[model samples]
Target chain A: MTLIAADFGKLGRSTLMSVASMLALAILAPVLVAALRADSIPAVKLNADQIAPRAIEELTGRNVTRDYAYAWRDLAAASESARADLLNDYFTGFAKDKLVRRIADQQKTGVRIRYIDHGHNVRALFYAPDGGEMQLVDNAQLEIEIRDGSKIIYREKVNQQYLVLMTPGADRWFVRSLDQLADHP
Target chain B: MAKMHSLVFVPALALSLVSSAQVPTLQVPARLIAGQAFTIPTHGQGEKTFYLLGPGSVVKRTVELGTEVKVTGAEIAAAGRYLALSCGSDGCSGTDFFVLPGDAVKISFLLHPSRVPVTAHNAINATAFVFDQFHNPVLRPVTVDFRVLPKNGPAFTKSVKTVQGVAWSEMSPAAKEGPVKVIATVGEQEEPRVIQQVASEACNLRIKARRTSKGVEVETDPVRDCHGNAVPDGTIVSVTAVDAQGRTTVDAPVKKGIARTQLPIHGSATISVASGVAIGNEIKL
Candidate 1:
């Protein structure tokens, strides 16, 4: 009888473990799917071979690339949702001001835009001697969509060019200026 | 990209986009310049929603179909890609355009090392960032005029063509130490920065010793730099005296212009004075 009781206890523990695992999976499934469907950061290929004044350090290059990708992600999210707060992390100075104002305009007119970024090929144009500022040109592959209320208004895929200026602050790089060029691939 | 009046720029950008139709369609001008107003043509009838998006500007409003939609200069002062959309019953049709930055009229100048030694070689960095009136970086190759003015020396000028909106020049502080003013100009805009060129290391340090009742007293001649400028007061001057017993050293600060120290000993000794990289003559007492 004692051996039977021990066997029953092992069965009970095993059942409990199985139930817990199933419950955990069930609870996390939606979140996992949502995260996967959420905005993915676009790849950025940074070419620093021709930067003047000084060469970029490996760590700096990595940080710049990561931060630039994050910036684009935030830009897409903020423009789509009309939430200016998302831009505060990676945009500063005139860049932030412009984006925030655009968000406000969208709120006023109930217009929305979303950037579906594919990737970017960026070339380093200038690097300040003191490392305070860096400028680059980015050729981006993107699919842009504009919406009005519940209606989809405009959509297109294009290879766009941009002139970007970044400054270091708070242990990261901030986009000070992001201007687009009229070049097509 | 003509020079449009600044007054009409705002209204042009304000009405830059609109379309009228059950299925909206719009056509934008081929060329747009920052801080310049523009007009666009739209198709369809009745009222429709207009939206314009750019790097630093966003415009959204209702517009009457078949009429011109104008954009204001203030609204389009930032240079970048612009999208103009017109939404109607059927769907939305839009056109995209690029706005080039206007001529550079401002210079943001950065000059490093506010204070440098006269002997420093290429220690002054002068970098100029050219900008349009809208504070947009000018991308074209504009010439930036650089003038370097040094106290007690001839002033010279150099012109550098900007690449990617920036131009830089490195300068060596003149041999005569004083204030050096660096100026950068783009079009009608000028930015000037000042740097102080101070004396370099002490030179020709000399020491004199005289017999005192207790021992020997040593003093340095007025400490001067190689350029004959008196070394600033409070500079450390080391005095070392060696005798039969051992060596006695006194670290003294230059007062007025000279440094003095007293060695308390009974016998004769050799005294030497040194300041910075300059070693003075030794004296036998």
Candidate 2:
């Protein structure tokens, strides 16, 4: 009985040692993997070409360009209701009303106006001293197609200039107003 | 049968005489401007009704024949074709007229390249469009005055007449760097805009290198233009080091008026600096 109890105690000690060693290995495995990863991962080298100037004008100009692209994309939808719903995400007040009215009138007249924004070149016109508002002038080229009763009536390429007003939001920016700087052809 | 025929014949004869005696005529101007009041002359005898229809509005009124009918600018504020019809007891007549845009009340002044390098030739373009209060482009000849005020120089002024409501002028930026105010004036209306005149590319850029603990430290002298104006901050300055091993280049931006970079050199390296098109001196250590 003594021999058997002594043998059992020895076995218990060995088993505890094995469990403790496994626990330690489990704890150190992640550290070892991380160190290996650190060795394999190369250091980040700064590329001169990748560095961009953080100018407010350039940043805001990009934002305005993107907003104009989105707005024009929304305006070219085939369905008036869908166009109105998408435009509400970008426009407000008189500009929204005018666009909605234009779409409604087109629907009533069985006419559709589609715009394809080729590109936009935006320049910062004015930024408020307090950074509350910014105005940008966008020179864009678009391919406009007018359809009547499933037939294209007219198609033309037009270069348009727009005066865009942007107001900063907490996380992003909002377009306050958009007006045509030049008369439409 | 004879009595009925006599009755019809007598009434038909009376109607023909009335129509012949009172012939309606309308006299109106060939063209009218939006937001202007005018009177229309007519000729007839008896009570007559007048109707005016235009692009966005319609007006109706009753007046005695031969009396002039007055139309207010508000009733004809829209620019398009207008029609006036007069219906008298005997006959009716209609006349048409065209409405032109009103006088200039606003101006949209656009200056291209809101930011330009100082002393650039013909780099700034100012374009102006005269607009009426109703946002219609006034397609009439008008003189636009462009005034450019530099931060620390004499103001430059130019006048250009508009063709088809557009006027534009190209001018060079000033020597000094700062905000340049551009103003466009048409009659009593004025529109002001600002263009940022930044320093031109670094000229005569030079640098120096010295031994540091890490390896070698390189720094540029105050980068200045040909006219001795300090180059603007955030302008890039490239530093390159070539050693026995290979070459390494660091494009550092000017901060606090100068650019500084630390290069790790093994031994006997040559270092050179440049800013834009201006190349600086080289040092071997």
Candidate 3:
């Protein structure tokens, strides 16, 4: 009986110690990994303007259709920044040409897209296919009429919503899917 | 005993603590279930585990924790001792949990059985038959995924598949009155997959009349229902008798189940039943 008790005590102590060690390791390992990897984590961000000119020119040389197809491909390849650039080019072109004629025109006449805002990693510029350096502006708008003062500009109304994506590398921002805003004009 | 209890409770307590932290953190919407297979959001995936518990301590089976799991069908056997889930062996054990969509939280019982019903509403006769996943007649309220296919017509390729799911009709009276073919798929693991098909005839207003040896008989017998049931008796019956050139004689108060008035020696009178009648038969009255 004494031998059995001694053996049980020894087994219990080992099991308790092993389980405690496992639990402590599980709890501490992630923290340790985070600390070691902290330097690699994002500290500064790159906006569209700050993006490498070579990367921008490589992206812009492709037409809008090619840009979108390449964007989808890049997204599949996990090159999210390239995808963002392609998307920016596509939307900028769309806003310059289609937004006024199709969307804003339906509400009122002679509507123009002003200056589009690109923040963080987003690059906003209007691309004219048959061009000689046309001025691409941010025609996107945001309204907080209920809390803030409301104002109407031009014959057409615009509403813009932007989203910020914080990934392991850095923080990048982009516009949501586009549709023109109208204010009972 | 306290130590033993702690051994059991500690894990559960820790799991609850972990889950509470996670509940508000996840922004993913509930999963949309497709036929048989469910796609989990690969949150940097290797294996994602979920638990499937039976009535009480009974654990039917554990499924693989992977990005994709397919459920061909399911059935209740042994009065619900085990849920026979259909799948290829992918490291499933009885002790493991069956991962289901988050909506499953709405349910209290694990082994809830649902049924798919097919009713022939406007069938002229009782030739209509309803078959379950096993091709058996089921006459109880059931919750299951269903698809509708028309006879000699293209079957709807897309089906509404739901888990944590009940046929809306099973829970509400309004769903029963509809004319729809419902197919139900269910099960847990192993040989428990089943597919049930239900056919319902739409409720339609139809008029039927037969000529008897007796003079110009006009009666509403076997009122056709669009949903495949014979029309009930005493539904306000009105009928019109018209001569060849559209000269008409409208009759009054022909009861729904039986509407009849003898017409004098007729040379093919066009008999038309009223639109308000559940069913109307056109015959020489």
What is the lDDT, from 0 to 100, of the residue B68 in candidate 2?
87
Residue-level lDDT of model 1, residues A1-185, one tens digit each, is 99998987978988988999999999878765432223588899999877877789999899999999999999999888888888988999777887887888888878788888999988777777767788887878887777777767667676776778898998899998887765420
Superposing every Cα of model 3 onto the true structure, what RMSD results? 29.2
- Candidate 1 displacement at residue A52 in angstroms: 2.2
Model 1 chain B poorest 10 in a row by lDDT: B1-10
RMSD to native for every prediction? 9.0, 23.9, 29.2
- lDDT for B277 (candidate 1): 71
B-chain TM-score for every candidate: 0.76, 0.72, 0.24
List the candidate 1 regions with Cα displacement exceeding 4 Å: A1-41, A149-151, B1-24, B204-222, B229-285
lDDT of 2 by residue, B165-266 (tens): 556778888777788999999989999999998777788788888888898888999988877778878889999999998998999999978999999886
Best of the two (2, 3) by lDDT: 2
TM-score of each: 0.75, 0.51, 0.20
lDDT of 1 by residue, B1-285 (tens): 111011121111222222234343467777778889888876557987778888776788888988889999987888877877776565566766777888899888888888888888988888888888887878778999889988787889989988767888888888876888888988888888899988778899999988888788888999889988777779999999999999999999999989988888668788888887788888888
- Kept native contacts, fraction for each prediction: 0.29, 0.00, 0.00
Each prediction's whole-model lDDT (CA): 0.80, 0.64, 0.28
TM-score for candidate 1: 0.75
Shift in Å, residue B157, candidate 1: 0.7
